[model samples]
Target: MTSTTLRGVTIDYDDLGPPAGLPVLLVHGHPFDRTLWAPQARALTGAGHRVVTPDLRGYGRSGVTPGKVLLADFADDLAALLDHLGIERAVVGGVSMGGQIAMEFQLRHPRRVRALVLSDTSAAAETDEGKRFRNRLADRLLAEGMDGYAYEVVDKMLADYNVTAMPDVAARVLEMMCATDPRGAAAALRGRAERPDYREVLAAVEAPVLIAVGADDAYTPVAEAEAIHRLVPHATLAVIEKAGHLPGAEQPERFNAALLEFLAAQV
Candidate 1:
């Protein structure tokens, strides 16, 4: 329920971890919200790092803008959120589309980023198949409505981990995804599906970077993680065994351990 004015948009966020601890910002991907980072946040906090999870524009309790918004706006909003919280610099991590945002944010605001984590994300432009996949899915959403969209999204992202093996965690993620504004979700994807190439930016990143992906992730495959690692000057890639696209929820123990260890090296 907490909110802050970031470039006229009221950014909604849940600030966890200890106030005195090193700040870590967690950004969730499409069709989900701040809650996606709950498990990771709790574990990071227990390890003495502050965690801040925000509901991106048009997701969860955050207000939706009238039309589609570019990912740059999301990055700007993140900067404002950090400024509002009086955090000068901190570790930033993102999953899926959120990882893209985190990458761009680090590129534009290097001084504000102490470290970077890209979880199950790629730096390449969307393939034609990717665009077609999104278009077909959008068509389905227009035809079947939010209920159908929710089912389809959950099936794609959470089925491999949350549903079959981790029902409780899956349910929590579904709750957040289903609660989102379907129109907002579609619009976010519509605008984001065409993001530019980030390889050069990735190579230019001087901050310590950690590229991670689930071994079982079918969406953003492990190859994407390797690709990112190849581009970054000294980025490290860690694979979480037996996990899916949403490693933060499916394999949080491993994800948190890798994240904490990488962050510790930065200190």
Candidate 2:
């Protein structure tokens, strides 16, 4: 893992694959780190595409601070990361909250994103009730820390198929969840609850889009993916079966099949 300072925040990221290869930036979701894309990164890098995975603002290997943050703050952080690497444009991909950030990145820095991969995520604005629920989650984390919360939500964060058939993936998910900084996790959750409606942004994104979802994903189900597919022009959709919210980890083979095929068609 490598660390760099951007806007006074210490950002930790992993830069792998050929230096001159087509750039591919992978962003991790809330309560997870760049490790979330471990499997996919290896495949992408081995396939000759530069893979850069970053620990989002308040997540793993990065700073741990509690403050008000918006989705744009996270998006801008990525733009800054790419600039630090001297990358003008790259294929941007993210899972869950990371996916939302990718969409936000397209909106904020259009020329910086050559393509998009939105995985197990949604583009809708956080509803009023959703905001309150997320705030309460933050409150719980600050009050009790991540132990119980991590275990309790592990099943939901992962799919049923993952819990039963992918024990190794489940363990890793639990490990990352347990290691989450309460303040950082809380801040991220709160920040995510304030993310903007990207439906309009999705429709406007000129880059080709790929929307991938775990068939069993409960948080951002197939319906959500379909809705996003309808909005994103030139977008492709793939629903990986026998996986859940974290399909990239739960079913890497299938996930990578769709991803690599997509990349091969691009630069």
Candidate 3:
């Protein structure tokens, strides 16, 4: 892992594979670090692609901000990271909140995105109830820390079957969440509550898109993925079975296969 200062914050990241290989940037979701993409990173790098995974601000080894951190802020950090690495463009991908960040990146830096991969995420703006819930959750996190919340959501993050069948993945997911700084998590939640609707932004995308979601994902179900597909008519959609929100980690083989095929034929 390497560390760099972008936008006055220290960002920790891993740049793997040959420097000349086609670049693929994968972002992790809320409360998780770059390790969420560990399996995918290894697979992509082995397939001769340069994989970049970063621990977003307040997650993993990255610096934390006490206040809110907007999706646009996250997108700018990524753009700055790419500029620092001297990369002109890359296949930008993310999971859940990371997927939303990817959308923000596409909206802000269209020329720097070669293609897009959005997994288990939505483009709709937060509703009034959602805003209230997010703010309340943020307050809860700040007040109580992450243990209880992490434990409660672990099963939802992965399918209940995954907790029993793939203990290692379950443990990793929980660890990432439990270890996250509450201030950062709260800040992210607060910012996410104010995110704009991206339906039209997605509809205007000229770059190739790949939408992958777990069939059992309760957080962002296959219906949400279908909605994204509808917006981006030319996108390739893959629904991984026996997986939930974090399908790339829960069902790495299937997820990697879909990703590899997309990169080979589309990007």
Candidate 4:
């Protein structure tokens, strides 16, 4: 892990892939660290693309003591990570809540994003039920503490295959979940769950966009991916069968293939 100070905040990240290849920035979802991207990063780098994954502000090794940073602030941290790495423009992708931050980053600074990918993420247009879930989740986190909250989230994150066929990966994910700061996780959830709808920006993003979802992702189902695909003029939607919300971890091979195909087309 490498550390850099940006905007008076300490940012921690990992840089991989070939030095000469185009950069691919991987942003993780709630309660996860850069390690969540290891499989995807390896596959991308093996295919000749540079990969960079960062721990979000207040998550993993990154300092969260500064307190209550917004999703836009997370995006700013991404910007700082890229700048520190001397990457001018790169492909950026994220899963779930991480996808929301990626969208905000592109909207705030389009020139910095060469390509975009969203996996199992809502359009930032929450339904009454979705809002309720967010609120209830926040309340639960405060009540049960981070460890208890993490177990619930980890259950939703992975599918049967992850538990059965990929027990090691599942264990790793649980460890990361347990490591998360409950207060920080709760704060991040509250901050981003209330973000404005990005449907308009979806239609406006000119770069090649990939909207992916696992076939069995109950959290953000394939229908949501379809909606995002329809909104983006140049977006392609891919479904990884028999996987759940965290397909990049649950079904890395399938997810990596789809991502590579989309990125290759862009190049």
Please report the candidate that would top TM-score against the real structure: 3
lDDT of each: 0.83, 0.90, 0.95, 0.85
- Per-residue accuracy of model 2 over 1-267 as CA lDDT, tens digit each: 899999779999999999999899999987899999999989999999999998887789888668666778888989999999999999999999899889889999999899999999999899999999999999999999988988887788888656867788889998998888889989888888888888998998888999999999989999999999998889999999988889899889999999999999897
Clashes of each: 0, 0, 0, 0
Clashing pairs in 3: none
**Poorest lDDT segment (10 consecutive residues) of candidate 3:** 258-267
- Which number leads on lDDT? 3
- lDDT string for model 4 (25-71, tens) is 99999888999999998999998999999888778988774335577
**Cα RMSD for candidate 4?**
1.8
Error of 1 at 142 (Å): 5.0
**Superposed model 2: Cα runs more than 4 Å off:** none
CA RMSD for every model? 1.8, 0.9, 0.7, 1.8
Model 2: lowest-lDDT 10 consecutive positions: 63-72
lDDT of 3 by residue, 2-51 (tens): 99999999999999998988899999999999999999999999989999
In candidate 2, residue 254 scores what lDDT?
99
TM-score of 4: 0.93
Evaluated at residue 67, the lDDT of candidate 4 is 31
Q: Sort the candidates on lDDT, descending order.
A: 3, 2, 4, 1
| Model 4 residue 223 CA deviation in Å | 0.4
